[model samples]
Target: MSCSEDPTCQELLDHIYELVDADEDAIDERSRALLAAHAAVCPSCRDAVDAERHVRELLRRCCGESVHAPAALRVRVVSMTTRVRRTE
Candidate 1:
């Protein structure tokens, strides 16, 4: 079934961006299962993930390796991300 037809799949797709931006080593077993199962079987989500990955890679390459944010900015970003995750 398409993700649009399944609530669980839609939820998975909704959070797929978090998966795309996540470091491989940061994913726990359950998170890995969700990503693996849906991304492997869902053609639309697989394509979406691929596109997101490409954009991430391109940005990293274009922005250059080792670009560092100011410490305050980094802290704010982490704090914001944490807050968002908590709310979710």
Candidate 2:
């Protein structure tokens, strides 16, 4: 029921977040290589990694896009910063 019983699976579980990153810098090169090699040979882990990648892509599509602050909020923030600077 869980990967906790197997060291290899545990390793994949531990690094799942890093494995799902779109950028290579999220994980060390050596650790990424080791996990990728492991996933290549392990179907369960490979599927798990694929699932995570899919989820990350979905989230990126849904919530990761950049946005401009609303005009009212931007004005409020600018006002706050101006007051703070004057007080300093």
Candidate 3:
């Protein structure tokens, strides 16, 4: 599909966080395809997604196989996310 027909940059960006938060195989096929199409044409979105994926991989490697944060950290992260979302 052409870039014009693909999801917009913001749409792809919204999915990138979800993509980064989950295993690739766990994401819905449509979202994966949308993100892939957007990333193929938009260098900035591609770089952003790539960076997010890189960070996720690095965290997985460093945190070991299970790859989960502590409860306190999760709480703080969620609180921060909520605050950011509220502002947005």
Candidate 4:
């Protein structure tokens, strides 16, 4: 699943966010390979990863040591998911 096989890199970039949220072992080999390959070839993706980490650190420092979505946002997300599921 190298980025070479998918030059757009969109899918791999999306999976990188998934990897951030996923448990350690939940990132499968293909995703890891794609990420590694993208990092090797794409400075932009590498910088994105670094920037995401830095933002997390900044939030932790600025927001009293932890970061979380607002309750209103969480409720909205849940409601939206329920609506989408019902539509499906």
Ordered by lDDT, highest first, the candidates read 3, 2, 1, 4
Model 4 regions more than 4 Å off: 1-8, 20-22, 64-66, 69-88
The residue pairs that clash in candidate 3, if any, are: none
Model 3 vs. true fold: TM: 0.57
lDDT of 2 at 69: 42
Off by over 4 Å in 3: 1-5, 20-27, 68-88
Q: How close is candidate 2 to the true structure, as a TM-score?
A: 0.58
lDDT of 3 by residue, 15-47 (tens): 776666655666677767777877888987876
CA lDDT, every prediction?
0.60, 0.64, 0.67, 0.57
Candidates in order, TM-scores: namely 0.52, 0.58, 0.57, 0.51
TM-score of model 1 vs. true structure: 0.52
Please provide, for model 2 over 1-88, each residue's C-alpha lDDT reduced to its tens digit, 9 standing for 90 to 100.
1324333877876777677663577777767777778888898788677656555454457668554445475446445554654588
In candidate 4, which residue pairs clash?
none
Off by over 4 Å in 1: 1-7, 23-28, 65-88
Please state the error at residue 19 of candidate 2 in Å: 1.6
RMSD of each: 10.4, 16.1, 7.3, 10.4
Query: Which one wins by lDDT: 2 or 4?
Result: 2
For 1-88, candidate 1 gives per-residue lDDT tens digits of: 2334333656666665567757566555566566757788887667666655554565467677655446465446545554654588
Each prediction's total of clashing residue pairs, residues at least 3 apart in sequence or on different chains, is 0, 0, 0, 0
Better of 2 and 4 by TM-score: 2
Superpose all Cα atoms of candidate 3 onto the true structure and report the RMSD in Å to 1 decimal: 7.3
